[model samples]
Target: MAFFGIFALIPLVGVVYFSMVKWNGMGTPQWVGFDNWSASLTDKTTLNAIKLSLIVMVVTWGVQTPISLLLGVFMAGRQRYRAVLSVLYFLPLLFSSAAIGIIFKSMVDPNFGLFSHIPVRWLQQSYLSPTLALPTVMFVITWAFVPFHSLLYQAGVRQIPQTMYEAAMIDGASPWKQFWSITIPQLKYTIVTSSTLQLVGALTYFDLFYVMTQGGPGDATRILPLHMYITGFKSFDYGRSAVISVILAVVGLTLSLTLNKLSGTGKMESQQEGI
Candidate 1:
């Protein structure tokens, strides 16, 4: 596992190092210290991308986490129909992101699409304007990710001992109180893990947004990945792209670490007592 982890981290390390240098992908590289990072921070386009990425992350977190948790707990607690329901919820995870994107595009199409029949041209109307496109894309991404996160949540909830619930009931705790004192505390690790996974996924998301909006009616849906694509491939500015990629990676890693610390799951034995 350590060997595989090292191999996986190699590319990430390369991108971070490359961000501190000037290179066009084919030429000899030159060290530029923090110039690329500084430029990425100050550039308007980069700033917009950062804003869009944050919007997507925030919306996805808000929408996906709660919905998935409810569905997961509901499904996990139902023994008779659990298998059937789990399959239904997890189906989205089995499909390609591109397929999901294509489906949403048609669903939100400006004219003749399913959404167009509802009076509002959801994808085209200024009411659902381009500036708000990032959240729209986040909605679709959230839908696609919910099932996978639900499965994680279900697994976590299942690990919680029945004895704890029994104890809560013996103490005359209400269902809400039991949930607060027992279910939630026990599920802390799962919640944190799911949130971290979603954060990292949202931060690097590309396929669903790319196919659904191509990052815009203008530059509205542009995110870090799309911004990196524009810089490295479209604009052919490899150095700047590497810098953005590095920022993205650091941001993702940082969020994961922060959430891990909050949940105490990184120290499982210590966490057991608190839960």
Candidate 2:
């Protein structure tokens, strides 16, 4: 509790206060009311950042969810061959995200990347260009994050009582039917938990964009987090950056709270804690 207050709670309070002030990276913060917030709201770049952030959030969740869930369910099987395959699939999880971004950035470079060496004409096109940068970023995010989410789903699938599958089979349920009725239903809570984390985490995904595209090819990949970073660090408008941060925090908290409300998981967690 003490740590939470000193770190998370206190910093959050400071951020809120800072959002209303006028300050560069240095010098004292001068309280300027909601001027910073107003400026952030009116900025064209900020709007683009917000739009890109939402698009990234939606596309990431959409692409990652089905693939992760399916891979997880498949890996949960007790097949001998899957042991090797599962390890291969999880290789991405072992690398740091920054390293993954760096490696891929090199791999996709137009002149020197792996794709440039390949004979394929389409694959060699400039991937980080304005026309293709957003898609490229989305693809990289999916590649990097799907394994972790699948691991969550795998654990959830394994926890399902084997007897349920057995009973379904005895009732003449086909494999697909068993999966639909048994597997999906059993993994509901896990889905909620995974989704809340994925969506919220997407809002704060800065490092990969920092190292990969650098919100580059002319702001094609500059989501809100990157925009905030550029504002704070590059532009040195700490106050306006704090406004963006507050906006991100508000959106993330609203998403989390809404998911918790819809899933009823918060009540369950509270009840379990009492026991």
Candidate 3:
């Protein structure tokens, strides 16, 4: 309660308040209720940003969920080599998002990035061009975030009782059948939690894309958070930016609550044989 109030609720109220008035992030905020909302909603660039954010959300969720799930299951194996693989998988999590963005930007640059010196004609292409910017960004986002989600799944997989697998084996179940019937059913709640985090986190992805593309190849990569930053800091349109912030907050909260409710995360039932 205390942390939510301090960090989320309070800032939300402040953003709502500021959205009603015109301000360049300084001086007294002039009253202009609903005007900021209207302008921001109608702006083509802002609309494009919203579309891009949704695309990113869907693509990341689709791409990350399966890879994370599979990797998590693989990492949960007791084999020694699996332990080594787990360490390698987690290395990306050690780097800051900004650092990942910068590193990737350099690597993917058509002019001076990794491919430039490789002399591979087919591989040498502009990754940040408008035709490819969003896809490349999506790939990087998946690469950077999959490890964390996979770790969540790994923990979930381990928490499943060993007896469950033993029982499945006794029933002559194959590995694939055990995974679908046993592992998938057991990890339902973890799926909900990981999915909620992934979806909400998508809306707030700013630092990575900011550092990587700055909303270019002609704003092709401008998600909502990046748009809000440019509107507030660069364009000095704090009022409109606050409106965007409120929209993002509302959408994020809605997604989280909706996912939790639909997943029945609050209604726990035992998955084990005799729990």
Winning model by TM-score: 2
Per-model TM against the reference: 0.81, 0.87, 0.87
Best by lDDT: 3
lDDT for residue 183 in candidate 2, whole number 0-100: 96
Off by over 4 Å in 1: 1-35, 119-129, 267-275
lDDT of 2 by residue, 125-180 (tens): 99889989888878988899888889989999999999999999899999999999
Candidate 1 structure quality by residue, lDDT tens digits, 1-275: 99999998999889866765433542227666667768878999899999988988788888999998888787788676877878787778777888988887777665656656675433445323576566667777778888877887788888888999898889999999987788787888788777777777777788877787777767888888998988888987777888787788678767777777787666422111000
| Reference-based lDDT, each prediction | 0.76, 0.85, 0.85
Candidate 3 steric clashes: 0
Worst 10 residues of 2 by lDDT: 266-275
Clash pairs for candidate 2: none
Query: How would the candidate models be sorted by TM-score, starting from the highest?
Result: 2, 3, 1
Model 2 earns a TM-score of 0.87
Worst 10 residues of 3 by lDDT: 266-275
List CA RMSD, all candidates: 5.9, 5.3, 6.4
